[model samples]
Target: MSNQATPWSSAMPEAQFQLMHDILAAPSPIGLEAAMTEGVLRPHFERIAPDGWGVKTFKGHAGIVLDTHPGRDDLFTVMVIGHADKIRMQVRSIGSDGKVWINSDSFLPTTLLGHEVSIFSEAPEAPGEYRRLDGGTVEALGAIHFADPKLRAGEKGVRKEQLYVELQIHGSDKKKQVEALGIRPGDSIIMNRPIRHGFSPDTFYGAYLDNGLGCFVAAEAARLVAEAEGARNIRMLFAAATYEEIGRFGSRVLVGEMRPDAIIGVDVNHDYVAAPGIGEKRMAPVEMGKGFTMSVGAIVSEQLNRRIETVAKDKGIPMQRDVVGADTGTDGMAGVLGNVDCAATSVGMPIRNMHTISESGCTRDVLACTHAVAETLLAMDAEESQTGALHEAFCSQHPRLDQARPMGHQGLPESD
Candidate 1:
């Protein structure tokens, strides 16, 4: 292994930024991630992992999965999964008064009060089948348009009916136009927010940074692993999944299908600004720009965690460890729980304002995570993995007699 970091490390910032922009620009709510994945992510993986490496798209019950596994069987596969969907709203009903009622999906409706939104519609042009429309915006409603003085105090919850999506017309005439556009009651609504860069080029803020950064990291890691020659013992699958905001629907499907020996979930970790309750036992800082955060807890594999930590240290990648007392609330945990038992752990990108507009993070931190993931894959030994054997040095010095048993044996015999 080279002592220096690969040139791929420097390329990650630009890659991360570009992917983040594309994903944020697409109107992909939880159940409406098809356009984003099929339009943006699939093409990216095809371009990056070329040479007949076609991107695989799998449709599921409530979501979609884009598979980017380079066909290599030199070793067991490590699946890198990321959720592509963000929390948004769904069209409920179009009122006769020209305003459309929307049901917020998994997020506060007040956060979307004044923001612009795009309602995806499939409207066909002349002599053509229905095509996707340019999308519309949020109507001037909610607390902003409250005519009653008592209701303008912002003390009450924004009811689903209080918020409205504007189709740009009024009354029955507007309803007819919206129907002509092919937008229905079940159509998705996306926040119309643009990604913004901070004072430094490496830092930026935008909506849906929760898992956008994760998709970027997984994409870059897949590209690096596919392009590198020394990773003969490492197989990788990059899964950009959907419907993560509400549940792990896509990830559960991915685990059952891929059944990889190990699954690494790349997603956002709540920074202090986003989740002040998260703290290390030693009071170690887990702030933005610090580095990648690895979840350590019940669902995480001890062997995988140890190997990843060793790889990150050897590669000089900055990383932080955080404890998750129960579930990590990530796709990796979903895989561990739903699929056959295997190695599972999650690496989180520190993000602020998660699930809200203006969620942000540092590109440098993303790069660190991308590098750590690639290095860890390269460091895994297929022999140890397939044999299901831990290193002698890694074994506990004082193995508990009660917990020790022969392979395939459930309990000690009465003779013993």
Candidate 2:
């Protein structure tokens, strides 16, 4: 057990809440996460890991490695991962009506209609501009005309298509003027909404809540561990990875580089909720405000999961168990599959309306997850972490990992 109080067990609730608000205020839509990463996450990380820890950024994927060993060349490392990127759409073109074209791998065109959006440009300096776009009714196209009314065409639900956005301005000349302001094709677009508060003292709502909440929890956990003194033998890594909504692109790069003894991918998990057509697909037995979740999936290491559960129970932190069949659809699977030796599992904050702008969760659950993670990391021993019995068991279940590609062969660029 760790001598240090589970850092963030007390004052961290408000801190995590504020951090979540700040992260949500910034517009971080998918590939355009440079602002969230370089602008927001970097400064916050520097503040938390100011001493000997080496902070590095790779293509907007930022990480801080805490070297408890200091000058020692060899040290055991455990990584906590969270994606900095959120799902968003890209600008396809500028319509003649001074409107913008929209396309996304994740949202239906109808769902975006009438919703406010923030357009992100390459502006590494000032963030993007916000505008409201009308999602015209099914009977008629709104301010921006769609080539096909089919944009809203599903009898049962909204049909997804390439959509369009209209600014308050109009005409081709006005469109050119708007483009001149640095808004151009290929920029990213995301739903815009102010943070909603007081659904109850414990709950709140906002956009990008899916994984941003995870990042906030991880940051709080890191703050506690960095400030503690007794953690001298086990090195810890805090990875704010990007581009997880589309795929595990950022995490694959990070896990290959860090190659930690164990990795915990922090992300949002869904609980019981009803959706059209899909019915209760969004429902889980877990509840927000109740606690964090330990996901069971193909990539989750049973031993690592048991360790986390033990920590949570011993510390009296509330927690729940969830199961996802083949893939958990989070970075935990990516890290585990890519680095066979590293033990991997996922810790989730129960969230509602995942992937939509108005995602919501309980602040109490966020703090609980932070406390659980901090306690788990603090309790880990270097010698015990390096053992790969779980990895051996996983390999036995899937023989092709050895035949198709051997372990310890994949290499990543050296960390800066």
Candidate 3:
């Protein structure tokens, strides 16, 4: 039965969530280009860019749906730059006193496997003193924790607990230094913490779940929709984009080209840290183990929001709402101005000590967003007319959310 008809019988289900979790558990964030191409995404993703320099593209079966203009084409393509590559670990616990810890409670977010982790030298001169270890504790989706204390004199403030790991690098003998023959750029840093699950039901603690969790939701939903074949008119495009933190450029290109009727960009939303004045209402309120969060404000479109809300209400999809004053800091910007009828929202995970090293989130929350997105895909029109909504939302949020700074173009050629 269709999700609408039976309500309880949508293609995306609880079991699917578990399956998705395992897939996300795979090491290395995105499917390798060679594999994704020679293996799976080949049929759908069209490689439009020149190869080499870690760049690849894929042109797919479906295109983006343009924003309401009544007269648009079916070119709505949702480009997703996910974390299938790169690992930013926070294993080394640095005390507020600015002391370093290689073994203590410090932790870095890392992928699982015999994957190599990077650590610098204990160069006596700087960073207090810390170096890499041959082997240490880096559990899947986890890292070590340390005790926070003043390592020496004149150190006041401190971050309580921290963990760290060592990373060895191989460089040219001619170019090697003490810290050299160590870690280098583009090294795949794995976490020292192992992922653990409590006896508790449906709970998990792991690393890389930050975006991996998000990817799980998106991929599985696509799998389910394909199986059910509920609606033929709806064409689902699952884009595994890369280089988001690098500059959010991958999706930028997709939005420009795809031009979907409307887009629901699935991404991780920052959790609310109990700051002095920031109440739950003001900042996003995505508590772990809850459902997903919906973004509001400039980046997210009004009409797009309405559509998502409509779907949620129609189905039993659980969601929370967040209001963004200036920029949602999401892929929302691309959807709006990139020439598409788009509703930008997020399925967020409540991450703790984000960007430091090892990030945290609830597995349940991840699953919910995935399911919600899948339902959205099936429900989205293979070809929906962009009813000028993109332009309208742009006008409203443009002045306020000056998110994307203009990339000054090469001016007209000088006169002869």
Candidate 4:
């Protein structure tokens, strides 16, 4: 019911759409994010980034940062991170019947049932080399006829411990047969779904859209900043980070090493307006195809948020405010977790069915976020040109509560 035109109908370039598709299609599940960070994101940055831009890699993880104006002490440094990791299941144990038991970390058991998946096993002989096995479907208590009365009546909930992958192995020594194929404990498993346009205009749905959309936006925004005219007074670091699903460990490492003056964690937020059974949850009414989301609470920097809001207003970009309570729930918390002194905030596109095979998002919101981030960087660059101390200026701009004047109301008297 949105008025926005679909990407097919709009002016979105073919190459951009293709890049988005490729990023989402790349399997970079949690601990195995090198597939995306190295294969997909690094290539895209190398191709489009300007001559002065250089890519930096972490020793501890697969996280990569594209840096513009590196090692400039005079300039403010801002890191815009989009996690390249997706939640995944890990091979826990294999049974003699050829059933692959998986630890469904971060995924509800109900969501995994009946969904096709691909398990990636690192060849023990080759160390880092991975072998992917397809044609497996997640299953639990296979048939309704075999289900107990409580399960049939939905009185019992499915638990992750009971789930196993149906690989349909035939013949004796099934466990050895699986092992011969390079499958083992601690291998990664992910949904075998590809990103596709949705029935609605400007919408996309697929597995791993949770954070792929984030990386895509960060890449696009970096491209925009690189192409823009003017001498940048601030160094922009666009990072495709890894291990966000596990505990944001990769981003924490990146921030601790880079030590940027500001950080913007670009990730996905739930489209609470369209969420089922979300009554009285007090969640923001963020919806797909509306605009990008800006985090307001938690460890978010008010001055940085205000700057982004000003930039969005000036550029005519649409955005929604998201209230994140204890944490932003994205890489936005990376700086805080690492005890780094930096201004941090989160920006995201509203998504539906996060952590599921069919996560949904709006292309329009993605594009809007890209523009908003790009413009905010440009705006800060412009500010630095005039102020000559962008970081110090931002630090000094925090709102002073004592300076705020009290307003009179019908029931309350005005302050003197």
Candidate 5:
């Protein structure tokens, strides 16, 4: 951690970026592995299985589970859900002839090339930078193409359907464009921020930290937990769930597996910024550069919150507090609804630009969450052991213990 942000902080690792780019490139209109890979016919095979991990699939779902704690295998099953799906990359119109005409929809075009449009709609936030696309988020039913009086095709004229949607990454040019960039549709388009490894990058950039950074912290922490002494037989799952952005589909399937008694979800929180309708209440401005923020509410059990707080305090980890009157719309939501009465909660890092590619994050924020979660897992040994003891005690108290004699008694008609 240097005073200056390190390259790692801003730079995406080859593997991370490749995996990210690949997944982001998928035609993941909604949790796309493959329409062909869905239930019924496909001979679905497990993709990634490590030693000591169980592999299973039911319906159109695939999952992995690790059972530690020997016989008390049923003690608690926790799930870590991270979205792996998103909206379909589509184009509504193509720009052309000094000005590319656009179908009145901004949503579709913006999703496609607006970010990569290589053109401008209006004055940019700063000089030389083009403003966000027109219609903001509206979908472009079609586009107006221009046969630049220069180069290859020699200016071919076409209609909306043939021209407009044809250039989109997920619409028409989806396959070709994605292949050109080695990307695909249904693949979640990550905010493509250049990760830097260092310090003092931003004082604020909160909320929408969501699961991306959360997943990273979990991954690093899981690695440490796995190799630590007295290694917490915690059987941690660093699930990088897909499709949360679309509809929380990843969380849906994951919750079915973990059913953890409680969970500490890692996401983002609103920064100390202001905007209409997004007041302090809806988007509490938890200060950035301070540390991690913890969510509190019925959804987040007091005991669990306090326990995490206690861990933070003891470890000197940085943290803040937030009130939740409604669902946080995170993997924690799924965790709360799962089989076990899980205490759902979240830890956040500072993130700016929310859903935009211009999103920024603090290394300190990510590190703080990692420390908090790692410590929480480390601190759970005693709690889990205590829970195991209580369970054993309960099981030993079977009321009809003496009611049924040995099976031999029933088998032999009482010789006496």
Candidate 6:
């Protein structure tokens, strides 16, 4: 709201930017997010968490939660979640010609063509051990000359079923050769693209920005909240969830288990203004480098949203209102789907080309989200210190239609 630039609008710290790059570089495709959860998120959390803070891991998955003021029944609990899973392809089968058939999960066939990928295959003999197979490219109808006239002319679209990984292993027993390398039918495959700065300032482009950006934002916010000085009457749960690309199962599980008083799901959103082929369908004019995004519909809690907006406005942090109709399409719905009675909402940074190999986002937006979330949590703590009943305060602050005053007509007075 101020003409002058806010502190968060500027470039983030060099170490923080490096942490973002590290998070995006680590591969954590759906059903296999341990590489991200244990390798990147856990270490980051441990490094920043205060002495009293603790970490909680789920039973059978890589989902993790960092807790502040744990096991405190007298304090209000807020769970901020960011899922760690990235959309990925799975090995469906292998051909004798060395072509590896794959199932494209949440990706269009056209965007995947010629993109390099790394296949993460678990060893058959050593079930827990894994091998990374590089130097493979996703392909379909190899070479423009081999395609049908209709397909080449754009009359037909290439289907995911027809896509395969061309490993270029030449042998009569190509299937046997591939099997010998421990590439099984269920191995996960992910893009090998690393995060890189875009042409513009504070912009970055890369693969798996969908949820890694979310996790990064959440981690940074947790660090900020932990460092803030306050009475700290609220219990903060910063969760890095898994399996969100599939169905948001990991966040739902965490929500059900923790059953917090409120939840804020952090994830990436589309920059609809710059997105291609979104003809005639009305969408929020969200853009990258503008600010972070806040959900305005679905299961979003009005009181919680107002709290976040107040913090952003007071801090001069920019944010855009995102309209999500039936569902937020993020982990914000975890509490709802888990049947937990709690206030919930989503916050995100807008990016271009979501779900593609070359997704783009702005560091300014990421920092804005981080600041907004951290400031909001600190604000809640301050309010709780004064009110002594944080949960009741939020629950009682919903907008009331009866208290609304009619707006005065500015047009010429109606003639009687």
Give RMSD (Å) of candidate 3 vs. truth. Answer: 14.3
| Model 4 ranges with Cα > 4 A deviation | 1-11, 409-416
Candidate 3: tens digits of C-alpha lDDT, residues 1-416: 12343322322345554444444444442222222223333332223111210223446311121111122244343333333322344334332332223332223322222344444333445543444444433332132233224423325432323333322223443233323334332223344343445344545555555455544554555555555553244323455544444444545666666555445666666667433354455566655555567777766656556656777667766677866777656555655545555556544555554443345555556656666665655555432333423334434643344675778788999999
Q: After best superposition, candidate 1 residue 127: deviation in angstroms?
A: 15
Q: Worst ten-residue run, lDDT, model 4?
A: 1-10
lDDT of 1 by residue, 123-154 (tens): 44443233444445554353356555544775
Off by over 4 Å in 6: 1-5, 410-416
lDDT of 4: 0.87
Q: How far is candidate 6 from the true structure (C-alpha RMSD, Å)?
A: 2.7
Tell me the TM-score of model 4.
0.94
lDDT winner between candidates 4 and 5: 4
Model 2 agreement with the true structure over 297-402: per-residue lDDT tens digits: 6778776787799988887788888878888878887666576467788998887777766778777677778878888887775333556343344345443435
Question: After superposing candidate 5, which stretches have Cα over 4 Å from the reference?
Answer: 1-30, 33-72, 86-88, 91-114, 117-210, 230-235, 274-283, 386-416
* lDDT, candidate 4, 217-270, per-residue tens: 889888888789533678889998888887898899999989988999999998
Each model's lDDT comes to 0.69, 0.68, 0.45, 0.87, 0.47, 0.89
- Can you rank all candidates by lDDT, best first? 6, 4, 1, 2, 5, 3
Candidate 6 lDDT trough over 10 residues, lowest sum: 1-10
Top candidate on TM-score is 6
Question: For each candidate, what TM-score against the reference?
Answer: 0.80, 0.78, 0.58, 0.94, 0.58, 0.96
* Candidate 6 TM-score over all chains jointly: 0.96
In candidate 6, clashing pairs total 0
RMSD of each: 8.3, 10.3, 14.3, 3.7, 16.9, 2.7
